[model samples]
Target: MTFTLAIVGRPNVGKSTLFNRLVGKRLALVDDQPGVTRDLREGEARLGPLRFTVIDTAGLEEATDESLQGRMRKLTERAVEMADACLFLIDARAGVLPTDEVFADILRRKNAHVILAANKSEGRAAEAGLIEAWGLGLGEPLALSAEHGEGMAELAAVLTPIAEEMAERAARVAAEAPETDVSVSDEDDDEAVRKPTRARPLQVAVVGRPNAGKSTLINKLIGEERLLTGPEAGITRDSISLAFDWGDVPTRIFDTAGMRKKAKVQEKLEKLSVADGLRAVKFAEVVIVLLDAAIPFEQQDLRIADLAEREGRAVVVAVNKWDAERHKQEKLSELREAFERLLPQLRGAPLVTISAKTGKGLDRLHAAVMRAHETWNARVSTARLNRWLEGMVSAHPPPAPGGRRIRLRYMTQVKTRPPGFVVMCSHPDKLPESYSRYLINGLRDDFDMPGTPIRLHMRSQAEKNPYKDKKNWGAPSRLRKHLDKPKPKKG
Candidate 1:
């Protein structure tokens, strides 16, 4: 691993701007708003010849209790502990606030290697604040203009030495390490390392209507207030991904902004946030369509679930705030009925109940997600598919058009990952939608595919031509008959 640097500061002090500058991309959402970044976002930072891993953390607030800002502070402190060095940025324009001083003392107590930097130091207007930053007792502040691309060379100059030292240490460790071989074949071991099974973290996105506690659920699952949450709706604007293990299963969960109905989402920012949430759903293999236990399935919720189904993502419907429900059994049953009736496409998919605030029923949700992923990627041998197809056709024959049934001649699995199938037939188009649904249901039941989208493609046999194999196309019928008769004369 490269040397890790953590940029810590109070809210809106250009921490994210510097992060974006170092990473050479606008990864962290930046605005004039304070505390825009409430989670620790890491990026591979490259400046000049120096390269290292940099973490942009939430603003170091003075809240040391169970409040939101306190939790945010705790997250930032955790970053400080994990990183090799800390870049303590103070807004030179608004230099050296009490919170910054308090945060500085905390860093000192933690014994973290600290690099003092004063951001927004562009002109004489900031000179007084920049000078004041020197008294923060960390070191001579590296004057920085993160937004305007100024003081970057000086900042790089300071970090280059540390980067070089880290590289040397890493090289030495690698050189000293002994080479060993596993008992298993290299290819098999490699496959075990990188495949979707358990090796790689499962990408799961939690999406739902605004105020459905999606962010709260993710935060509860991670066991840290890693995301910003409030009583207000749509607290999360950006789709933030956090990595953690769920019951020994590595997982990456994205806490997305709650989606409102498109008609109601008139603000440009809301549209972007909703778009980002949609993107997270598409990027994810498994999406947890969260619903408020009290409100249950709204029209917007149905739309979101349908979108996930259309995207061919494995789905789990989670009713959040289950602890607040008065009649648990009845609510669960009601939720089930509604889920099936409203989102028929995701019927038989896991509909779990949980309180993201209290972290209930997460294990069941976890299991369901894993199962859905497996179902989504399920495959069947062509022989087995054909066998199943024969039984299905026998059970309910395709609709006969003009007193002739549209024969399903054969079936084969074209691919997996949402389980696509191809059926060769006499007349594919003659197969009705209801019949196709029947076949799909049969496939689902016979193959035990649950809560996963299934694809079916139909190909009709080529029409036969009477003269397709003829040798002499120009020959008249009389000449052809005469030629056949001459063959009898020769005999």
Candidate 2:
């Protein structure tokens, strides 16, 4: 609920650099490359005593409808509408271009409160270019250098008053708000709140390799050109989150940058983009790892699926560009084989084939996502788990190491949201990895938790009886002491 300020301008004009400076972190990927940011990324920004929300948007570009740049422009305009103020940046070193002049008017028409800044105004050489920026008719431009940290005090002076006003309003509203009390049930897990919320939107992140139609899929879902899509690869550089409803379920979906192999990812900017996509996976409740149907289950795709599994996220494999495939049956077979063969760790995950461009098979994908989410949050009672454990162990006895039988005494469900269980046994270390997999697979099948990650830990303990671990197995008790007093030896 903080005050929001958005950085707006053409590409490669130090907008992201300034955003990073204000946020005090390298949250956005910054490089000399133009059009690196295709979506708006939000962060909590701080400059001196001023604190507010900051958004970094894609550059303003003019293009026809259905084109990528045009879509990016539309998204940026949406950001302008949401922000309290806009910092319109012009590159002083490059001087004002025609696009800058055009966008200056656009910002004026689009937003009421716009602050103009001439960035890269660090050295004397930029003075002439800085002077030229004033001709755009956005009042006198604030001379600033985003990279060199100059003119920040001036920027702070202008923002501090605004920040203070926002703070006072927020405090007043909070003070007037009423408080409510609610009871938390003891039967439910304490971390139930951490699981996916029913009232809130379902957070789903669609991520995959470059040009796999991630943006296209999101655009199809929203029935608008909400994201930029093109034949070009690596168009999406930020994990853009959009909110909408699928059926009755409100959903928040993230279209992330395509993940390439670590060897192919060399640029500092791309590395940051990949990291941002990875972060989206961690935050998401259900992650749809999109794949190119024409060439599905590539090495990178396997790695992405593995990463999601390692994070314990509910996974759905979505093969995009399905309409482009020539051999439908053969391709489907190939996808299935490759998915199960390459990513065995994510066995039984939903493999949904869809054409993001044509909007084909989306319903199936939606169903799969919903199913995976339900399974991820699924829980089983301790009595049920213990009963199932006994049946499983009786069917396939655990390995007897060194003639000592590894007795699995009992098991209980420890948690849900990727259902975790702990099994009490003798010599837990002696339990084989294969047996652990067997138990996990059984849990998945018996509990109807397909595609959801399961955690099982074997903990060692002695027999539950109080005298089981006690010494004196051959010694007589007090009640039998009189009868056993050397009578056997005398006979």
Candidate 3:
């Protein structure tokens, strides 16, 4: 029931400035350049009592076939269609230009509810341009300085009515719907009843190469002698799931058998243990891939991370035995750089250095797990997604091979257990693997979906069948005709 407002305009019109003002945070990277924000950034916005979703779009510009601008235009159009209203921003000091006119035309054609905002209207120089904005035919201009935070009260007044109407309509629609068992009940308002039904504690499987301090780290996090501690490789045979809480958060820690090269894994029980550990990864929401601080970023460690990514699980890297190591700073930095370079998919992923024996950095490790879990459940609005998509297309337009440019129509998140998305397009098969990687990287960087695997699927328009048109699908026409023929003259 959230009313969505998209701030859209040509480059350098202070859209990001206003976004920072409304969101009340510097979430979007702001710069003086026209296209510093090459992604659609979204935040929960509040203007007085009004609460709605706000989207910041990239700077609009002209584009040629297979050019970035063209892709950006397509992205913006999708955002406009998804939004309930749009704030068409104009640089008051610069006055209305041909790009503004073109965008205004586009907004009008979309029939989206719009408010014309003349940003940077604090000084005397902006007065004339603010007056000139009235001719854009988008009603009275709301003149305000995003940098100085002027005219926010007036912006609230403008948005109040729209917000109220949207809220009321949503309530009415919700009132007509049937309720389910999971729906909150008035009688179950007490603390005991309100507590979330905790599922079977998350099954976490810690897997890495031999002598990776898997048992030591597990013992340190749980503060118990649950697993046998030894310097010998492969001390544990079977994968074990132990119930424990990490700072009030319930967790099931699985100490698994250490994996080695396939040629070295000769024992029958060892092979079974490896398969069992992998199954645990598939079931887990968050997997802590422990690495020895001395030999961090080994090929085996990369393979473990890749497996976790492929399995669509949240991952956190814990560089253990840091207390005993010399040159700790250098090693930590090296580990981080290698992570970024080798595993671009897990951008912004948490990397913690800890001493398993001393329990150092365990608090940070726990925090990282919680953060990764939240990001794994994150959902983006369709409007904001399209806006971000537009910026990406503008930055790097999709490739064309045979004079026919690829058209990415729309993207919608179909599932979120593993954060899967489906992008509807004209030619699903024609998209290159590199382009898919590019989009995935953008998603990870912009949305803060680090240390998690994201699934992107392309679907063709021709494959969809909405109506299910088929002969004799419902009631036959002959049966309807017989019924209409007066019941066979009353028999």
Candidate 4:
């Protein structure tokens, strides 16, 4: 029963500030520079009793061509079309410029529900602009200062009736709907009883170097041009998330900006964008490192994929633009070899070949993502792990450091979701990194966990003792001390 509200305005008009206030978090990147935001970012907005989805969109620009600004304008217009209401914000200090008038007309024609507001209306200097905002012909413009948290109560008051009206309309529609009878078989009833409750959506992130088709791939997967895509290298500047259903599985997919090397990321906005993308990778369960097939596995691509592996997320390397390549088999072979050689930590990970433009090979990509997720969450039983440890230790015993054998005692899985294990062995500090890698590789191979990072830790047997650090050595309990006292009756 919730509605969606989109905050629309030119660049540097406090849209992001108001969005952060409503969401109660700094979800969007805000800066004094114009066009800091380039994607449509959605967040759950809470304003008093009214709850709705709020989309923070790119600024409205006067461009119709296929330039970057034009594409951004198109994206913002799309948001306007989808949103239930549009909050048209104008800078009060700057007053209503020609750009503001142009976009106001655009919103008037595109969206029926529009709330005009004059932002930065906290001083006498803004009085003229506040008075001028009414001429836009939408309605009475509220004086708002997003930075100072003014006029929020008025905004909430305006939104309350709209929310109530929508709710009532929805309830009336439900009441008018006819009821249908459904028959359930005994097997169906049993199946329903065995079904698990609804769970949270799976998180997936698509990351790669500039012009590697990350946005294009996501748009193809979602079956819509929801994201702004072009031949531009850095068209996206925010890690935008969209909720979608991938074949019965609820998923939240993140489309991140292209991440260049540190030296090339000199611009403040680009650096912020890269940091935001890195955050997305850390939050995701499975990460798809998209690479251009023409030049697959570049240094930056390897670094991005390695970062995902280091973050302990499931890694899926996808070579995009396969349809444009002439020799598919040869190119794919080269990609596989390069992947295995360049990123040994993510050994045996899924390397999927996809054509993001033509929408070919997405099914394989989806399968690989699902498989990697399953392997990442794989857990082995304690008994099986111990037995496997025995075989591994017997096959190649631990190296003797200082002429002393490092005895391996037991092994057990400590956690899953990237599958962590702890092995009890003598002189864990003496265990070599090569030996740890050997054990981790063995675990991966034995448990059918491929491409998922595995954490193997060693612990000494003494560390397992519960009373190792008890005070007063082996002092008796109070009751035992009283019982052991001299027998006064016998005396």
lDDT tens digits by residue: candidate 4, 37-112: 8889999999998999999999888999989999899989999999989999999999999999999998999998
lDDT of 1 by residue, 1-491 (tens): 47999999888999989999999987777777687777678788998877798999998887888776877788888889888888999988886788878878888877457889989999888899888887889888898999998988888888877777778888999899997644664456532443454446789999998889987888788887667677767667778778898877788888888898888999766777788788888899899999988788888989999999999888998888899999898878887887778887776898888878878898888888888988887878889888888888888778889887788888888877678999999878877888888888888887899779998989988778888898655589878766666454563
What range of 10 consecutive residues in model 4 has the weakest lDDT sum?
189-198
lDDT of 1 at 18: 96
Clashes of 3: 2
Clashing pairs in 3: 40-388, 68-394
**Where does candidate 2 stray beyond 4 Å?**
1-5, 22-25, 44-53, 61-85, 92-99, 120-132, 143-200, 325-330, 463-491
Error of 3 at 102 (Å): 92
Q: Candidate 2 overall Cα lDDT vs. reference?
A: 0.86
For model 1, give the RMSD to the true fold: 4.9
The residue-level lDDT of candidate 4 at 108 comes to 96
What are the runs in model 3 whose C-alpha is more than 4 Å off?
A: 1-197, 463-491
**Poorest lDDT segment (10 consecutive residues) of candidate 3:** 189-198
**Each candidate's lDDT (Cα)?**
0.83, 0.86, 0.79, 0.89
Candidate 3's residue-wise lDDT over 360-456, tens digit each? Answer: 8888988888888777767778888888888888899888868778878788887775788888777778889999989988898898888778899
Model 4 bad stretches (over 4 Å) = 173-199, 463-491
Best by TM-score: 4
Please state the error at residue 130 of candidate 3 in Å.
99
- RMSD score of candidate 2 (Å): 5.7
Name every residue pair that clashes in candidate 4.
none
Maximum-lDDT candidate:
4
